[model samples]
Target: MRPFAVNRIPRWISGAVLVLWAFCVVYPVFWSIMGSLKDNQQFFNGKAWALPKFPLLWSNFSYTWETYHFGRYFVNSIVVTVGSMALALLLSATTGYVLARYTFKGSGLLYYFYISSLMIPAILTLVPMFFLFDTLHLTNSLTGLILLYAIGALPFGIFVIMGFFKSLPRELSESATMDGASHYGVFLRIMLPLAMPGLITVSIVNALSFWNEYPLALILMNDPGRYTLPVGLAVMQGEMQYRTEWGPLFAGLFISMVPILLLYAIFQSRINEGLVAGAVK
Candidate 1:
């Protein structure tokens, strides 16, 4: 076989595989959105892939928002996701800075400890965490959920941020210190802004994870009113099984997807830059 022909074979195979993977991921999403525009009878009686009839049922989204209390759940998810990201970013940035910049006693041990936490499956800790939170009267509360997400996400955040911080030249911090900058000033003015790429990447990653997280949210949020979007959607699905409002169910799923999609769309460049820089460094 010609050298070019041999090389083209793998390229073609890889391209085909990627196209198939893309279809697998995107087709269901497209189907859900289309199905959301349909009504129960059309969705069930008509072909699964058929387009909605003229004058789409846009009301399904409204019904989901008002009738099913998804509005409350949506707000709860926003609050929890934002709060968790803020808390996690703060903790990760500070801890990562210390680990990267200073050679304090046991700092290596501490850094490894954080990294080690990432190895353990979160499911293993769920029961113990639930009991601990219950003791603190934090169960079924948004605040508790936020804290849990922050803590759960911390290990990976620190790992990513620390790598970025470590890649920076020591002279940057030293020069800032010589120019009458305090440790706080250097960190706040110099390091933090410089580390924006990593922080953005971490925030986007954690946002997606927290937004889609279901099992822990299900376990923590016992009150119907406290449900986040994922938990709320699951509960709504269960309730709708008998009622079989497929359109509204798919509508709820689409609504839950909007924020995260918008988030990724906005920060996609930053995420790519961060990952590339991290990998290069």
Candidate 2:
């Protein structure tokens, strides 16, 4: 009914932008898949985007595993990411709830201080954090990585969860208190259940980041066996520089992404709910 709504040029431009973005994402994935099927020689000779002309080589996965110690790396990544996400969510939820529900001196200033970290580039703190971790003997330890990741993820997680908690009806907590429920009981039983969607969103986002983290792992972790998947892949490429085994490299990259995809698939509904909740408030 509106003139702008009937505008063809705006619709066409928006549609074109989406198409371009889709191509940018899809083409690389398609190329990577194609590359995984081809041997090194075939990858070099064949068209970059075309599928392998020969039967798919299943052995690439085996070679990738044996060569890179990928299994160990994958396990380490999972352990670190899951551990960090759990700690971060637990801490962030408590902090967010306090900020959202309580009115105290400098609460606004406290939140400003917390969320301000998000605006700072991570690279700026990387060196300082590394130095501090070294002083505390946290370098090259999984425990150290987990702690740093959890703390680093806190700002954004708290911001998002705080927003969600603020949007919640305070009457629910009041009602629970009227029934003689303690603060812990109200939070643990009532508020947490309602905040599950936001927590899931934060968890998924943090997990993805911790899983794929490269620069931090590269700086902190020195043991080859303790390397996370991203660092391991980098090491693999470095070790295999002469041969350039695109097949296994692509395979490893594809496999590394599987867990994240699975997490998204499983918690997809909650993730959507959290996104909508954040936007609505």
Candidate 3:
């Protein structure tokens, strides 16, 4: 009984720690939602923990959407996220599959090259990339942004997806090939389906980055019409300085959070499963 009670003490401590961490994360989001409902006085006054008052200011969302052209930004973000995610996943899958399965001259070097690229500070290359984009006429365009994002995260996606490929039982691919399946057929029908978890993980990770990216968009999206959500939000925040409109700002933040929350909620289980399985492999 003494040993059992002592073991339970660690469990109790861990549970308490998790609960505290959860509160730390969730309470601020809850407070922000409540803040979105209140006027500046109730929000910034001495009632930070209090619930919103009666007659919720739902107009905050409407006003921001219409007046600030957030609707346009929302659509642009959707387009960029989807387009870049699809392109990145496809490229990563194909590249990772070959690299993980086949050993060719310089394959090791090439993989290391990608892994090493992660070390170079990304910010350092921004100015050079911007000049290259300008030279090639790739600036001020969503397509250019999509291409940049797709290439930018390719190393990470390749690393993750390659692990999935290497971990998979080679018997599956060999069995498919024995039945007259070509390499493409084996990959498309067998290996690709088995690697869904890695695919989802890569897409979700890149989707979040592409959705929230700002610095590149800030430099390239020179035209107001081409602004992504983060850039648009920054612009809005600047304009809001004189007005002090915290309500709409909070509302926009809430809006920005919805897609990411939904994405994780939908694919939460798969993400953990993929990481664990790939790690073991």
Q: Model 2: clashing residue pairs? A: none
- For model 2 the TM-score comes to 0.87
| Candidate 3, pairs of clashing residues | none
Roughly what TM-score does model 1 have, to 2 decimal places?
0.91
The digit string of per-residue lDDT tens for model 3 on 1-281 reads 45555577899999999999999999998987877787787767846688878899898898878788888889889999999999999888998999999899999998999878877887887899899889989888899999889989888888889988999998999998899999999999999999887888878878878999988889988888888899989998898868888888888877778888898799887656655543452
Residue 280 miss distance in model 2 (angstroms):
12
lDDT of each: 0.89, 0.85, 0.86
Work out the TM-score per prediction.
0.91, 0.87, 0.88
Identify the runs in model 3 with alpha carbons over 4 angstroms from their true place.
Answer: 1-18, 44-46, 272-281
lDDT of 1 by residue, 17-128 (tens): 9999999999999999999999988977899889999799999999999999999999999999999999999999999999989999999999889888777998997899
User: What global local distance difference test value does model 3 have?
Assistant: 0.86
Error of 3 at 82 (Å): 0.8
Model 2 lDDT at residue 230: 94
Q: Which number leads on lDDT?
A: 1
Whose lDDT is higher: candidate 1's or candidate 2's? 1
Which of 2 and 3 is ahead in lDDT?
A: 3
lDDT tens readout by residue for model 2, 43-79: 7786777778668887788778777688888889989
Candidate 2 Cα deviation (angstroms), residue 158: 1.0
